[model samples]
Target: MPPFVLRSPEVLLSVPTPADIDRIAVVCTDPAIAEWTTVPSPYTRADAETFVTGMVVDGWARETMFTWAVRAPGRPDGTVLGMMAIGLIPGGPGDAHAGEIGFWTAPDARGRGLTTAAGRLAADWALDPSGLALERLQWRGFEGNWASRRVAWKLGFRYEGLLRRHGVRNGTVCDDWIASLLPEDPREASEPWPQEAPTS
Candidate 1:
């Protein structure tokens, strides 16, 4: 599939380019992002350049994964707000349409719903008949990643319980929370989302 762009009222999603290396490196260095994601610890300029110029470029070229750099609308060419991607998940017979979604937001961009918006756009595109025609988009995050789980929930991904020691992250086995979104699911929260009580 050829690379494409997606835009919403507040954000723009485009394929990452070499120009984004500096920002990518900066964002990936955040301890929070590094802890919850697979990005290398102490992310470096070299790593960011390789990711943008090599992994990202090759993934799109092979049509095996689609990654987008999220930015604010006013200065779409400026700093990246986050990154989101949807990639093929090899499946067994009768499950060829499976795909997976992953994302991370810059520290400054968190709590503003930028990643949620970007995720919705990517999910819609992936499930559209005119797009990848994927039957479902799966989402997974470390067990304690309530922020990521909340984003998936807000986008109507049905909670599918936890997978014990399902994958490795930062060199350690970790449990993951799983969810899935289908084309027919409503694009709104599917269950009650309670907020923490205010601190005294």
Candidate 2:
């Protein structure tokens, strides 16, 4: 229900166009994207190119994963805001129905409510039955990554628990926070989640 033509203000699962690569690449290279997330330590233009042109596109085409590129809303024209993604974690229906969310913002775009905004959008899209019959959507981040945790909390992902030494972060093992949103979730702080309850 968003106004952007290439991607919805609500979500952006579609593959980004070649025209969008440069702006997206700039955001990808931010040290923030490297420090907290699983992206290669020294992010590069080739990594960005592979992601936009290869990984994201191929994943969607193969029905193996989902990804999105966030864009700003209500400007004179659309402004590239950030990016987000949800991919089916390994498992069968009972397990695979649960997807995982990941995202980042342009350095200048942070602290402006952009990450939370994009989280709500991507959550809705990921839960859309026509898109993916997700029973739950998860957000996992290093225990100390307050920014990542905040985005998950703002979007209504309850803290399930923490896993000790659950993730390899910046070459060190770290605890992780596991949070989720069920298909039946009634409210997402910043945007509307699906109305229908999750099916078993």
Query: Which candidate leads the pack in lDDT?
Result: 1
**lDDT (Cα, tens digit) per residue for candidate 2, span 113-182:** 7778777777876788866778888889887777788788788887788899999988999999898888
Residue 72's lDDT in candidate 1 = 87
List the candidate 2 regions with Cα displacement exceeding 4 Å: 1-14, 74-79, 92-95, 189-200
lDDT of each: 0.87, 0.72
lDDT score of residue 39 within candidate 2:
82
lDDT, candidate 1, at 127: 85
Provide C-alpha RMSD values for all models, in order.
2.5, 7.8
N/CA/C clash count, model 2: 0
User: Highest TM-score: which candidate?
Assistant: 1
* Model 2 pairs in collision: none
RMSD of candidate 2 to the true fold?
A: 7.8
Q: What stretches of model 1 exceed 4 Å from their correct place? A: 74-76, 92-95, 194-200
